[model samples]
Target: MDYGEPTKLVFSLQDPKPVLCMNGDVKVTVEPNGRRKHWDYEVTGSFVQRACAVRSRAGHVVAQIGVKGMLAGKDFYHVVVQPGYDQAFVVGVIAILDNIHGESTRC
Candidate 1:
């Protein structure tokens, strides 16, 4: 695959699941530098209980354990990815939301 091509990756959850725990569409723009690449995106939503791992086509993780949350009715999250680490980063955001809201469990 050419590293100069623009790519868009998306992950979504369907019905039977509450939208409160779902994350909105995440758009990643891949741009090429001199000998590396860069990625950037904006997230909009609340109560995101997901963990994502973004990797490249060569299996290099560009992002890991990306968590999304809300603060003062604003969307806030942290993406632990290092830019220009590799070429063609494939992101896989996993949802780990469960019925912990009504349960009393601590770890």
Candidate 2:
């Protein structure tokens, strides 16, 4: 599926009180690389989110965070991130709707 233009979002990191917001719609291009699919995202967000005072080997911030928006019908998806030099943690958020079976479904 083609998402057309990328969506924008924001992320707030506690501790020095840093806020990151994308200037425009991020461009996400997904392609198949070998066995796993690779997602290439190009975004120009504000200051990266960092936790604590740890720094990288190159003397950079230890962590960073960002957010992205997704569409699940009328509901929306928000992605939280904890970016590091080698790895990152991502969290996805979606609206909860009451279904007939009392369960949530994704559009």
Candidate 3:
């Protein structure tokens, strides 16, 4: 099986570092590499209810994900991606968030 290209998850250390939250809330900048030369996207929200939103540099909410329901003790999340945004990328970021917070994607 072929895994896709490398995806990087960068956390800011200063200037615009992410805020700390006991509830597992996170804020991160995505795709800041110099080659593409574009503004980075930001993902922010809480992991408790799987509520998260991705915002563009222009301060628009391009995508958001939240718990839609629970069944058999498992949560179901609903994701909404605005036009011109990458849906897969948004979901990938959420997956990374889940992994980081020891949620659904934990080992």
- Candidate number with greatest lDDT: 3
- Point out the worst 10-residue segment of candidate 3 by lDDT: 9-18
For candidate 3, lDDT tens digit of each residue in 20-78? 44543244446455454444566656555577677776779988889888888777778
lDDT of 1 at 25: 37
Task: Please say which candidate is ahead in TM-score: 1 or 3.
Answer: 3
Q: After superposition, how far is residue 79 of candidate 3 from its true place, in Å?
A: 0.5
1-107: candidate 2 lDDT, tens digit per residue: 98464653232212221235323313223332335333233223322221112233244443334324335533232333336423321221111111321435354
Candidate 2: list runs displaced more than 4 Å.
Answer: 1-59, 73-84, 88-107
Q: Lowest-lDDT window of 10 residues in candidate 1?
A: 96-105
Higher-ranked by TM-score: 1 or 2: 1
Ranking by lDDT: 3, 1, 2
**Highest TM-score model number:** 3
* TM-score ranking, high to low: 3, 1, 2
Error of 2 at 24 (Å): 29
Better of 1 and 3 by lDDT: 3
The per-candidate count of clashes, in order, stands at: 1, 0, 0
